[model samples]
Target: MSTFIDIHALQTLPPSNINRDDTGAPKTATFGGVPRQRVSSQAWKSSIRQDFSESLDSSQLGLRTKRVAEKVVKQIEQLSEGYDKEKALSEVAAAFKTVGISLAEPKKKKNEEEDSTLESGYLLLLSNQQINRLAQAIVEANGEKLKKADVAKILDTQHSADIALFGRMLADAPDFNVDASCQVAHALGVHESEPEFDYYTAVDDVVKEAEESGAGMIGTVEMMSSTLYRYANINLNGLVKNLDDSEAAVAVAVQFIKSFITAMPTGKQNSFANRTLPEAVVVSLRDDRPVSYVNAFETPVKESAEHGRRYEAAKALAAEAQELSETYGMEPVKSYVLAVGDLKTALEGLGEETNLKVLLESLSTDLSKVLAN
Candidate 1:
């Protein structure tokens, strides 16, 4: 049976545009007949990936870009002494072609010759180990060339932690596709919210008081503030299978939990400085399946005169989760919680209350035992 790890958080952000639409306004979604501020899962996943680099080694991570050929070329040059840029590019192109990924022809610039940088048709996700192995293979080939089966095998296995968690889709090579072991939900506000605009101006610093009487520039930025409910889950079985290492899987899981809890989307952060920690967090280990408490606010939470939205939202979430678990007999095998203010009391029965440090330590220990089996 597959075990699932579900992470839920209730966070509050001040006036900020963490995720925006094409019109440069904060994203919003209508729920329960009311509009609520929204943050895309893509945005949060990116933040989580960025956070991974801080704690994990670069070798355990992957690179997603259209310049896979160029990266391979650089690696090839570094691995061999005699190979120049042109020779390395040729070898990289031939190697990718063997695996059914054709490098696009170099596009010429205006009044200049064609650029030699080779790129794939779309973004490719590759692990550092895979790149190194491929480069070594090319260097070892010594002009004999690599076989399709060999190149395909290298591309299919040895996935990095991020690739194992997020997965990858290769349209040109469907056989090499990797299904993601994790799912992230779009964060939604617990209560109705409306976009608010900030209108301001900047004065020309060089202009004197007599030279300029008015501001030099003026503009408005759309933003919103609200208490948001964020949720995500990871399939431990899938992650372990992708990584092919239980120990590494456990480490990745720990880092993922910490990143998800702390990483914030940095959209317009310089302007608003809206960085804040979650008011409450719940991590649940379930043998049956993952659960999301987002529907708990389907009716939309309301702030009380004494308690704010975060407190009210946490209370509602706890009540809803308890009722669901009891009614459906879906109680988790283990649950841990980190909360502040009145939220501690509100979510006491939800799980074992602890601090972030202790919670992560306990999680790593528990995950090891579970994955060991």
Candidate 2:
């Protein structure tokens, strides 16, 4: 129910600049010989879940929870009037301050307090299998009673598992304990508005003639949509809390959410060459590869598109196809591989075979047929 985190932003974050060298502090590393700032697999996981929870309309968590709890304290303070209830609520509010969890806040207006984050994303820290494991732990903790789990699952939930553990957590923990954890899960089944995001590519309009007038024809092009999804799972029981295991609910949720992110409101992304998109050339071997499109059909490529604009086209198509493969059950991916190959072939054919008239015409038709509106 939210936009995919931007990998560019994720890659550029300054390494944990904090002075502390503690376990929870941010981490840094040198990737490709460049000093890179990194959110630990842990930090990355937590950040995403936090963001996803908000966009999905699940609930505000962390310090926000404390503020809301403070609001409740304020009400209790009024009810307490002259009674010790004021002191008790005050003390509880302080506990909330210590843990940074609360039950209330200066009420946000309707459609207010979105959890959208700018400039960052997960870079394959937690694999899908790992995400599932984390959800399992959280479910065990909730056990029809997050209150009674007695910190067993809390201890069990690791930093690496942060994305699913916290995001789908529907109940806000009120009791204090050794874990020092705060933040509520999205209230069971609250329609967390889905996370929405997009990436697009546009083929350019290119001309071969240095014109007092135009030449034979302009370069052919097309547009496409790209998306990369990291971890996604929904615990329906967590949201519904109908069963002892809240985490299991999200299994269905994860699929449903993944579907929402892709294949809905399909359209072409307008990213174009240089003026709109300075192309990044990339080359990949495609020979003898079995690629499938939406699992409707599949085939292997005759050659790897490389060494030119075709290379770049191949790269883009490859990236999108691989990404879509994760969620759409393979057919979409196959379709992508075919289009990219077809495009690469077309581009490579330029300047040969009579200005590539045949190739260009074939490519234009192929691009049009395979890429649907």
lDDT of each residue in 1-373, candidate 1, tens digit only? 9989999999999999999999999999999899999999999999999998888998898999998888888888888876878877888889888878888875666899767788888899999989999999988998778999989988888899889999999889788889999999999999999998889999987775568678889999999999999999999999999999888988898899999999999999999999899999999999999999998999889889988778889999999899999899999999999999889988988999999999999999999999777
lDDT of 2 at 340: 32
- The regions of model 1 sitting more than 4 angstroms off are 106-113
Q: List the residue pairs that clash in candidate 1.
A: none
Candidate 2 segments whose C-alpha is farther than 4 A from its true place: 1-29, 34-88, 91-248, 251-373
Q: Identify the candidate with maximal TM-score.
A: 1
lDDT of 2 by residue, 1-373 (tens): 1111111100101111211125422233333333322323333334445444444432212222222323433444454454344344444434333333332234446988853211111121222332333333333433232232423343223322223333323234323221211122110100111112223334333543333434444332222112111222222223323212323323323322322222111112122221111121111112122232211101211224444333433443445555654665533111111123334453341112222234334433432332222
